[model samples]
Target: MKRICAWCQTSLGEVSSNIHSEQAITHGICDICLNNLFADRDIDFIPFLNSLSAPVILIDDNNTYLSANSKALDVLAKDHQFLKQKRTGDVFTCENAHLEGGCGHTNRCGGCQMLQLINDTYEGKDSFDHVPVTLFQKHGDVRHKLDLELTTEKVNGLVLMRIDSHK
Candidate 1:
């Protein structure tokens, strides 16, 4: 695959600046296009994410959902409005999200692997792919566990947490 800017389609030379630069891949925006891609005061991520087949959720530094594609919203059985007012945990129906401190402020949050992944990606630590995660989901009065595979990528300071597959 040819390394090219996701936005301008300019060849990124031989190196792939994407999250998976270590591997032979071709998908990511170039440095020159980064500023303009995000410069718009109201950046709309739905169009970008809509191109993917998987469930993709766009989250900010505080782990708040900025926007999600149809597949993502469908995964949560929610609409755009529902996601706008909720965080990742709330959208995923994490059992611990209902606690006093809510999403990221609870004691249990300390051991949250997914949150750790997000933090790592934000801090430019490393990129991850197909990482397995077990989350307990609450539906009405019942709670169930879901084994999901996560693919995290840092794009323009925003983490695109893509749900690759689930069981």
Candidate 2:
């Protein structure tokens, strides 16, 4: 049978792998579907997030950055262009981000609470509010441990990672 994109019903060709196989991956959406869903108009979220006081960043399923509000930009101490093409670690200047593979590719990423929270929320497993997290941030070759509070909510098929408070 031919596989199809769950979101847009586009044919993806035959399914060679068995559902019972551990290596088999069932694709719910195609790359084109993802691109279309996250097209240029995705930035429209910025204005909406701007209405809120918290720092809000939109992330996709793979933990890739989508867009961030002005408050988020301020919190990261960077402009929109700087945040562009950057992952979570790059945006927050995580120490692991400077590692060989960077961000999600590092071994430390497996135990990352923020990543767990984002994945859980994305899978509809849980939601969080003002959850405290400790992450290492790199500055001038020195790693600083930062205590931060995070709030996450899934809205309009996108996950919103909001920086509620930092200490």
Candidate 3:
């Protein structure tokens, strides 16, 4: 099979039989390409998901980190424990968060634009949709206010996540 790395336009050097599944899925970029690509990421560019109180970190597409809110961080941590370790692949597995039997994954935890965009992209085959998210935040014993916008864009086949905040 002929494919290009999603993060970079590098010619993958491997024959079909020379590939391993887990690390060689060819999802996007070559390991080296991703590494070089991430090296250019702003080491100080912190996108805070919260405007008040303690801060949280957001692991976007390809392990890029952004700051998040306290409550939202809790939800992501509890719901996405593997994020702290793996920090890649499909982070949100729980669907039907809006359905009756759904885990309600979309509620009050800010918007999971990454997960939702991944779903639409995968499920629709050729569609891109931004998930609509609404959340309420509470700090310790007090609830702070915020509005969040999450978005995803595919660059060279690599999904880049975006989060916007309002207070």
| Colliding residue pairs in candidate 2 | none
lDDT of 1 by residue, 35-114 (tens): 56555425987776686667888888888888888998887788988778577788788899999899888888888877
What lDDT is reached at residue 18 by model 3? 35
Candidate 2 C-alpha lDDT tens digits along 1-167? 67766656777667644221211111344567555544554455565556555688888777778788888888889887777767788888888887878778888898887778888878877557677888889899787998888878665466778787876
Number of the top-ranking candidate, with lDDT as the measure: 1
Model 1 steric clash pairs: none
C-alpha displacement of 118 in model 1, angstroms? 0.9
Tell me the lDDT of candidate 2.
0.71
Give the TM-scores of the predictions, in the order they appear. Answer: 0.82, 0.72, 0.31
Q: What does candidate 3's lDDT look like per residue over 1-167, in tens digits?
A: 67655445676655344332322222344556544544543433223223323333444443433333455455444443334433322232223233342332325323544445544543435423234544444444555433444444343334444333334
lDDT of model 3, residue 128:
36
TM-score (C-alpha) between model 3 and the true structure: 0.31
lDDT at residue 139 of model 1 (Cα atoms): 87
